[model samples]
Target: MGFWHTMVEVFPRFMPVLLEGAVIAVEVAAGALVVALAGGLVLALATLAPLRPVRFAARAYIEIIRGTPALTQLFIIYFGLADIGLGLPPLAAAIVGLGGNGAAYLAEVYRAGIAAIHRGQREAALSLGLVPTDVMRYVILPQATRIMVPPFCNFAIQLLLATSLVSAVAAPEIMFRARNLVMETYLSPHVYLLAAMLYLAVSIPMSHLTARLEQRLKRSR
Candidate 1:
């Protein structure tokens, strides 16, 4: 049978599972994104910290996470943590792992973004009587965030795709459901093809939206 025929034959049975997985996928991505942003910001600030020890620790974490494979991180979170009697749900473990990993990458992005700003901008903000926090909030971060948007959006999409690895820990995300369908129907191409399409559906729009938002921000400035 053709791929379309296979889709028709399989979808009715699989759609429910696929839909559930999609929900899980969105939930995981959104949760991870939030964690990544919060953690990344803290790490970014630490990167500029005055204390040597704090700066060293932050940089070390970023390097370690960026250097390691996310799958290994997931295993450490899911399995290794269980060894210590800190048992988290598989889905929670996946979120923490993915979010923590993404945070490291994003912290570097934030660091670079902040660094790209002209030193004059910081001096000027200080001269204007703004406190350090006020300077970052009003001057430095506002512009740096604009510069960071494109790369950050790309990482967000990567995070979305990375959620697939959660399946290894029994998180029932889209790829996990796809694997189950493939096992039952033995229709690898169609099952995976549909999964890819669904991912593209989400990712493509997000990319475009980010682009449009960047443009709008530029115009407003």
Candidate 2:
């Protein structure tokens, strides 16, 4: 039988399964992003803290997480932690691992965004009887948000693609299901190609949206 003919036959059976996996992938990405966003904000704040030790500690975390392979981190969370009686379920491990990894990256993104705001604005807010917390909440973050949005969108796309990595831990995301289907059907090329297409279907639209957002931000400036 021809390859296309084989694909046509398997496509119907394959697509539904893959779509289910894709939903899980989306869920993992969304959960991880929430973790990342919250952790990143805290890390960013820590890095900018007045105390030298706090800043050093935050920077160290960013470096260590940035230095390591995410897959290894996932393994540590899922497999290694199990040996120490701290076992997490596959989906939970994937979310925490990816979220922890992404926190380091988004910390830098957050820090850079916060830094891009002028020193004068912060000083002015301080001079106007605002406390440090109020200054950051009202003056600094509001402006930094405009700078942060574009990069945050880009990171979301990266995190979505990175969800494929969770398959290594048996989280049943897109690539995991694709691998299973390929093994069962022995149609590596067709199965993998469909998986790639599913990713592209989500990612390409996000890329375009990010681009348009950037352009709009530029115009508004």
Candidate 3:
């Protein structure tokens, strides 16, 4: 059948499966965002630590994660970790792998954002007799969060895209469902097109919202 013919006949059923995938994709993205933020904060602080060993370890992790392909990391976490009795479910493994990879890049982003703020802000906080943690919590982070949000939002989109790789390990996310639909229907083109549109539906709005957020943050400064 022709493309529209395929859409008319199959698209309705295809949509439910694609929507399921999109839900999983959002879960994976949200889960990884949490992990990335927490992990990035620790690594970013480590990179700025006074001790050389702390800084070296943080830098090494960043380099190693950045140097390797994310697919390899997923494989290692899903298959290789299983060999050591650390087997995680497919979704868990994907989240851990992607979040770990994201943390390295986010660490650099956080470090740059923190560094970009004026030193006077930190000094003024300190002058008020605020503790070091308080200074960072109140004075530094507010501004750094603004600078970090754009890149961080971009990273969130990248994380969403990367979730597609989890299918290799048998996670039944959108791409996985689409591939199954292709095999069942012999309609690869239509199946993939539907999936692409579904992804676009989520991503395009997110990008626009984040762009508006970035503008608001900049204006507030």
TM-score of each: 0.92, 0.97, 0.95
C-alpha lDDT of candidate 2 relative to the true structure: 0.94
lDDT of 1 by residue, 1-221 (tens): 58798788877777777878989989999899989998999999998999999999999999999999999999999999899999789889988999999999899899999999999999998998999999998999999998898788888888998999999999999999999989988988888888888888888998898889778877976
TM-score for candidate 2, please give it: 0.97
- Across 1-221, the per-residue lDDT of candidate 3 in tens digits comes to 57798698887799999999889988988998899989999999999888999999999999999999999999999999999999999999888988999999999999999999999998999999999888888889888898899999888987898888888888889999999999998988899999999888988998998899889988987
Off by over 4 Å in 1: 218-221
lDDT for position 206 in model 2: 98
Pick out the ten consecutive residues of candidate 3 with the lowest summed lDDT: 1-10
Lowest-sum lDDT 10-residue window in model 1: 10-19
RMSD (Å) of each candidate, 1 decimal: 1.7, 1.0, 1.3
Across residues 188-209, which tens digit of lDDT does each residue of candidate 2 receive? 9999999999999999999999
Q: What root-mean-square deviation over C-alphas does model 2 reach?
A: 1.0
Candidate 1 lDDT:
0.90
Runs of candidate 2 with Cα error greater than 4 angstroms are none
Residue 143 lDDT in model 3? 80
Give the Cα error of residue 115 in candidate 3, in Å: 0.3
